[model samples]
Target chain A: MEDLFLKLSAILTGFDDLDPKLGSLYYKELMKASGPPFTALLQTFSSKVLGHAASTGHPASADQPAPAGNPEDLLRENIWNVMDFQILSQAIINLWYTATLKLGNVTWVAPPEAYFDSLLWRAIEAHPPAVSGGYFGYWRYPPEN
Target chain B: MDKNYDVIIIGAGVAGALIADKLAKKWKVLLLEAGEKGRERVELVGSYLTATAQTLGSPYKPVPAPAKNMAPSPDGTNDYYDQPPGTENPMVFKSTYERRVGGSTWHWLGNCPRLLPSDFKSNTLYGFGKDWPITYDDLEPWYCQAEKELGVAGDHEQLNGLFGAHRSQAFPMNRIWPSYSDLKVAEALQGAAQQWSDFNNEPMVLFCTPQARNSVPYDGRPVCTGNSSCVPICPVGAKYDGSVHVNKAVANKATLSEKSIVTRITAAKDGSITGVTFIDWDGREHSVSAKLVVLAANAIESPKLLLLSGLANRSDQVGRNLMDHPQGEGLCVSREPLFPFRGPPTTSGIDKFRDGAFRKDFCAFRMSMGNDGGGRTQSPANVLNQLLKTDFGASLRTKLREKVIRQFRISFLAEMKPLPSNRVTLSSQVDDAMIPRPKLSFNVDDYTMKGFDRIADVMRSILLALGSKPEDLVLPNHSTPFLAAGHIMGTCRMGTDPNDSVVDAECRSHDHKNLFIAGSSVFPTGGTANPTLTIAAISLRMAQSIDNQLKMSQT
Candidate 1:
């Protein structure tokens, strides 16, 4: 679970060094929030990417010791190399951004906390306008870099 | 259960609230709202804060029973309004309104431009569409009263002669300061006008918009703090909404029953409205008898009710001649960092094309400049995904920052001509309460489309002058065309001819003497302006006429 969490976090945030504890909590919450089908999809996506990394002479196996240097770079490279992994990676990225698990036309709205933690806000450097941003006039200034 | 009242307003939106606030002082006025009584301002603000997709309806919670979501439904099924097969240009007819106590105003942007003098005389001057029963001069005083009531802020001098509207008084408050993007755009346009003759033309001035949001603390509301969330919800009560008047009406002794959706309008044999029947959330039916009935239930719902109850159809115009401001937008990246998305969603607009001989050929349009920088484009996860595809590391972060700061967008809302064929009828599909849903058939005619085509060029020119390349301007085409501006109008249009219009000069239905209608639904023609201010002004005028008639009958 920890390996899968780190691998998924690396794909979403483009960083493997993200706080492991926080990553694990987000992964657990996301799995619960996304329910069974989507969580299974995420698990499959992580294993495939990690398996590809293992074949590429990298120590990405769960039983193997933590690989030297950036594991995210290897996973990201494998993500772009494989077509299905790329699609799944994009879907996982979208899951963080929209906080929804969409299968065809059906969608399950994610919990508010998931939306609050969406990396989309972090990428844009601004909180959702009416949501968690500060008081009335806080938006008047450019978001801090 | 049956209850009696001096007057029963079918909606608790701005129109009904304004009318009830005035009439409740001397009469027993009842305001029936279809949805839940809205929460306090703070609760709405909180909802907006946590909302995942902060679209127009984000702040307010939707009613539990099936209703339209503001954003387009994924499966192309109508959630709010049902559009049947064979409806022309049905995709462009999308609109969503809150059924809550405050109605759509809870999600309104608070833009309050008055209709031009020519708007009332469109048929007489342009030889198309029906002329309004009343003129701008007739409603000028009422506009001032409405502005005062709504706490409108504006630069009066900038608005002078823009559309030939004569104001009897200045705005209630001074204009909100323009954002950096607005100032940069205005400056760029000024420079471009020197080189381009079209920019110097009459009625083409870019100026501060008169808005209903407060620029200063007035009427017990705080000044707008540039929340940039005005459309979905105003975090503070700085923006004017129907709830303000609704609360005042209740305070003035008007009775309000929320979650009571009026389904039928009963009338006597002589075509005089007797009472209305409504169903509560619990599925219990109730009836309210009134001396006078005012149907302020918005454009679609009011006409749907009339068709359902089989009342006010003397001329067969209850749900005909539907109109809305069909709009197209352009996105551009400025060479300089304009830093959009800091202030209100919009602060200034270009109105030179609002009126002219150009109307003889096609529709006129208003170019509203947005201040949200690239916020609209960048905020969407899909668009951001596209933007982030090129870079993966720190380069991705740099690209995001650069693109967001320099992005600018503007939209053109073209005035659509009223067509009887473009109408709202009752759908076969019924809700849980068994009320028939409204099915709309709408199409933007060649006249409006030509206007859209013309505005595309103007939009591109403005973007180019603002430092965007011709290739960089993303303009709409036929395949991906104008969207609904949510200013639904002309369904129950008002005019001098009772045979052609649903209501008379005073907005009193020709068939029912004691029945009145309010809101944008009664507009004879929708001009190139937002319609809420006009809705308020017309409601105030109707309230006065009703008061006078009641007093005369008493005497």
Candidate 2:
């Protein structure tokens, strides 16, 4: 989940500056496409980031000990029960960056050059076109000639 | 005959409501309302965000539409009164009055004050316009009647040299306690009233203006909670609305036909009104008949109806003498925040400048304060956008919140002398039904501007004396032009002579024997006070005259 978030966040940031045609095309693609294709790519990246963080045995979730309650019961709660849309949006963005910092020491499968400045974010950015412009900088594009 | 009516009262405003309610108790009445009853409930009055969309001031908007004029846009989703994209007349001024049932009184701030004695004889003294057929003494009892119905609350104690108008009885309930901020400003003016002596110099005085809204529960309504949403709707029903009277009148057998837009009052060959033809909201034409006709549609539409009916040109004065209490805005700085954000609607007033043998053409008064947030009271996004105009990013939100909640502001109400040329007539453009629009031609005179400046200076000095900083002063300038206070008056003025007046002293039109004009339309001169009290008084007088006429026919 962590690696997946990181890849998604990075991909969104690349479109911060883009050609208008490409931006519009990307915006349209995101709307037409479904989750699984993106999900497989995100799952691979998140696992790498999460594995690196978990190995340190300092999971951010571990710092705040859970109250005396059944773990299974807590898991049974709906994902929405924990946070509303606004808080969830902020949390996703923040968590992605935090996971990146945690996994900074790991040797990424694709290597820093092949992935960091290139692959993951670019793929995600191009995957989704924005509607009414995207959140943050992902949807914006330079004026058409 | 198309049809005939005993009386045809146009407009469904407070004035119209009173006339219909009174006359219908004895004689047959036909009340015509151009707009629907629930318009304010669904369209004008809603959540702050939704209401702001319908209102003139909103955060999402930099400049909200002007209050009146203009038609529906191409989409027909919005009716921007100030400026429409493709209209013959584009410029807009702030005169927001609802054409719907109960009229603009639905959005009134509930500040009801009587016109001063001097206001009655302005023509005799200053040689302008016509004199009221009835005197202050004649309408005094009527003012008392209106106050009771409105459930006003006030000090009623003496102030300055004038004792104010004598109330037949005390306010329905005790006066509202002034807010801590109102108290501070009131204390400072206590001394100024004495210093300005001659005007304040009279032997008697009245400190505060009586209001139509409740301070404490009276009759059946609750006291005002100071929502400051008085210009729109009272969700709690604390303020008086003319519709409340209309409802009662209906329950007591007064016929109400909502969405009935009267096209014209058709008259017989003998010049007597035979009936009125109207189209309802669904485009169905209906004719109503009675022996008499009453026009209470307000200064603009009342004249418009008469003109359309061909009853206007007889005296050629139906829409000729249009007038309003020429209201303008002025600013003064205060050291301490007066908490303008909170209040009972308008408790105190300064009559220090209401009259004088000294100031030839000027009369002014101080109304309660209003909040002037530095554009922050707008929406979060809007404030951000404005801040983006000046600066960007992180600091914008913080600064916007601080500015949006300004708490101290006092407004002054001044009256412009009656100008005959400033009238409401027909424009070339037509409505959805092809009827001409009301072409309003008006301008504030230099004399009134000087009066506004002087009032602002006095207010500033008083604020300064009360420990306000001179640097925080908001001066009266053209940046904020004094818009119409919506207390439309004097269009069809009353006079002793038939030639100069549309209605005689009794509010009976000089030209049409069976036609009567009620409401502020017959006001000879409106004082620097809200016209509701004066309007109620005149309606009460007209009711008696109407009853007398009905009785004479029987005899």
Find the candidate with the highest lDDT and give its number. Answer: 1
lDDT of 2 by residue, B248-324 (tens): 66665667777677888877887776668888766678888877777788777778778778784556777765666
**What is the Cα-based lDDT of residue B267 in candidate 2?**
79
Error (Å) of candidate 2 at residue B176 is 2.4
Q: List where candidate 2 sits over 4 angstroms from the true fold.
A: A1-145, B1-5, B39-48, B52-93, B159-164, B188-206, B331-333, B371-406, B478-480
TM-score of each: 0.87, 0.72
Model 2: lDDT of residue B117: 72
List candidate 1 segments past 4 Å from native: A1-24, A30-75, A78-119, A131-145, B38-77, B87-92, B194-205, B373-379, B387-391
Candidate 1 on B1-555: residue-level lDDT in tens?
A: 239988999999899999999999999899998877756777776666555555666667642424532222111236656775564644547767877888888778899899999999999999889888788999999999999999999998888666678787999899877766777787787777433243345324578889898877888988787767787788777889899999999999999998888888889888778889888877778988998999998898889888998887888888988888987678888887776556688888887888877787889888888876543444445455785454444445456656767778888888888999888898887766777778888887889877766777787778887888666678866677567788888889898788888899899998899999999989988988899999999999999999998888678
Decoy 2 TM-score against native: 0.72
B-chain TM-score of model 1: 0.95
